[model samples]
Target: MIRWNVVLAGGIGSRFWPLSTPARPKQLLPLVTDAPMLRDTLDRLRPSAPPERTLVLTNAELRDAILALEPTLPPENVVAEPRPAGTCAALAWAASLIARRDGPEAVMVCTHADWAIGDVPQFRDTLDRAAETAATTHALVTVGIVPSRPDTGFGYIQPGTAIESAPGAAGEVRRVARFVEKPDQARATQMVADGFLWNSGIFAWRVGDLLEEIAALTPEVQPALVAAGTNLERFFADVQSIAIDVGVLERSARVLVLAGQFGWDDVGTWAALHRVRQHDGQDNAMSGPTYALAASGNVVHAEGTQVVLYGVNDLVVVAREGLVMVTTREHAANLKTLLDAMPAEVREP
Candidate 1:
């Protein structure tokens, strides 16, 4: 029933400060491989959803760049958000477009443009399962990654009672017992040990169902949707910025979670490269002609210059555009704070 896909690609990727700027965010960067993350995302989904049926929602400033990345998609398909209304409004608008074109019953698969999925086949399978589950159950569906580690940066979902799949066979389907945001290290570890799943931010739902739930449960974005029909600017101004998880998934009772284990990583910060990128024997993940003599647990991204890490461990080194930044892995995600403290001359181009 999934006839369309809505890809959210508007984030500025503040966590990756030095490399990710307003014009060129992490979504446009080749952090995972040689191609841009957005391009990789489209390519990953093309097998199940064609570019004709896909709609990309991005900021006004980055519309041209996104359209340039995929020429097969019509110019109108690359929609530029009039304002930063967050994911809830974006998804709502996307669902409205799908409903208008494909009818209310058409299922839409929603995902972000900036994610590192290791197993493409398994990843597609999980999404397909989510789409199938949503089609048959007529419920908002989310894919929950089987926790591989105690990641404090991501939200966790506790699964509830099991349910039968579309074929009446018992599947990994379960009602979401609870949703917990980024937690302390102790709590994250305990949750992982207790079989909690990482909130993958992947969703599937019919346009009618999603809109109905939003109208009933999320009042903040519901009014905006009414305005979205006529005036997008007023809609963004009226709605409070809210993520789909908090605005809809957490509050909606008709939500289901499916256990997913396909090597998923958010790649939120520079340090995340160590987890998603391929590493050498020394446990170093490097790109753009780099060598490590004895480095271990270091993530390096070099461009326009060769970088060699000697006997360094747990460090992040980035070289680009004549600017070099070096920081410990633990401090890599804090680059935003560092950028804030830097003078405007040094912070912005």
Candidate 2:
């Protein structure tokens, strides 16, 4: 089966505050390594799906920037959503495009762009296995990450009874018992201890299988998809803002979860920098011109001048383009509320 990968790179990333804005969002920023997260994602998946087949779906405002970032990708392969139509609609459009070009049997690998993946080879290997499983069983396959800890920030997946491997795939595939929303700390801890895997948002499926499933299970976006044809803007205009997990995957009976274990994080908040970036003895991760002295568990990102932190612990400090933000690590995740309270002028720039 032909392999096609869809990299969804659309998000405002408000949690990153002054550093991440609409023009240069988290996926476009070089948060983890020297390159942007989208570039890292492309490099990792190109082995399985080349630039010819890989598609980068982003906001219409960010389309030009994405093209500038990945010049090797075909111009037509870079698609921009006219509006915020959610992943279900985005993937439906992508699958439709792939089906039109390659065929309905093509395997499409879908993932977000702004994520920190520590193991590159392992990540690609897991996707390969997931695609093989999809091709073999015609199942909507998802790579459920082996939970390293009880993370309340992410959704969890419960694996059911052991299932036979797909025809050519030799990976451990299990039926999806159930999909759980983000749980509280205690519930997350209990689920982790009970062998629930973190839903990594990495998926693989055949174009036909997914389209058939969407046509049967999800009427929220399917009717719009049918009416729009090649007009993606029309599709988005009519489709409801329902996530793929809820609109399709959660409702499908032909779903399989393959347990994956490669260091992965969605990097949703400023506090995630501590987990992904390299830290000093005091557990400080800094980017750009920044210095931390006797600062333990602090994340500093400075773009203009040097940022020196002394005698502070567990603080998130960021400086960029004359905007400076300082907040405690515990409070970093709630930057959305803080942004919402601020005026548009202050929040945008």
Candidate 3:
């Protein structure tokens, strides 16, 4: 078993706006299941690690909210970041904590909270292999999801030459050639044809090795890490915003990629419900009482309310207390822009 620390959870997720606010972010919303998304994320790893070993790094404002949702998790394990300094600082802070408490050789796995996994056994098997690979190779191991379709929203990982003598069970290790960000539709199709895997944002690494990579490659947060133990607020104020993918993963030479066959979905936008949830014969995904007439490929979420749609196709309708959002499925990806265009008084809670 490997020690796990989940990063990349502190997101407002404007893509799921109106329903997802700063106080209750996407991770806290019951998007995929009845329980909060974070709870599902934690449950996915329960077989490998216990609640005490799990660490959740969230914004200071949402600490109480996270704690309420997950009462079993230790209070101290729910680390509240002083500010939003991006994934680099978050990972560094988590690594610093783990290294100080545990040892340098202690392997840690990192993942996000707002994700849906269809197969738990496949996911655990992949993580077990990833942990063994990280411990044996002393390198950063990332789970590159086996692409089920041509997805342009996620990054792609190109596997390099295989590590023949790498320790671990069979089919556990492969060298990473490079990391590529989201490409255009045409390019994304070609990437799938070229055997590129979706960058699942799941990572495994040793505490000492990750610290070394952060110190060397990410200067924006290096000083923050050095000053982390003393004052978290001061450290956060001094660091620049940068994601771990740009700061370390892209620059690190010792990165390894393992093909993950488990079904995974980031559940990024309202349109993504078509992939995450079960659709009816009319191609509509309805959570509550929703009657669709001549409508196909629509996502309707009505919380204790009756919704009636007629002659609407490819639309997202979400009805909740003090909020009613109706937008085309194509426009779901641009919800942030829509929120920005609204008045402040209407936008502010």
- Top candidate (lDDT): 2
Candidate 2: global Cα-lDDT?
0.90
Colliding pairs, model 3: none
Distance from true location, Cα of 255 in model 1, Å:
0.2
Q: Candidate 2, after superposition: displacement of residue 40 in Å?
A: 0.8
lDDT of 2 by residue, 266-333 (tens): 89988999999998878898888987787799988888788899999999998887788999989999
Sorted by TM-score (best first), the order is: 2, 1, 3
The lDDT per prediction is 0.88, 0.90, 0.86
Candidate 2 Cα deviation (angstroms), residue 171: 7.8
Candidate 1: give the clashing pairs. none
lDDT per residue (tens digit) for residues 160-261 in model 3? 888866766454578999888999999999999998999998999998899999988998889767875656777788888999889899999989998998
| TM-score, cand. 1 | 0.96
Model 3 alpha-carbon miss at residue 68, Å: 0.8
Q: TM-score of model 3 relative to the true fold?
A: 0.96
- Which candidate tops TM-score? 2
Residue 323, model 3: lDDT of: 67
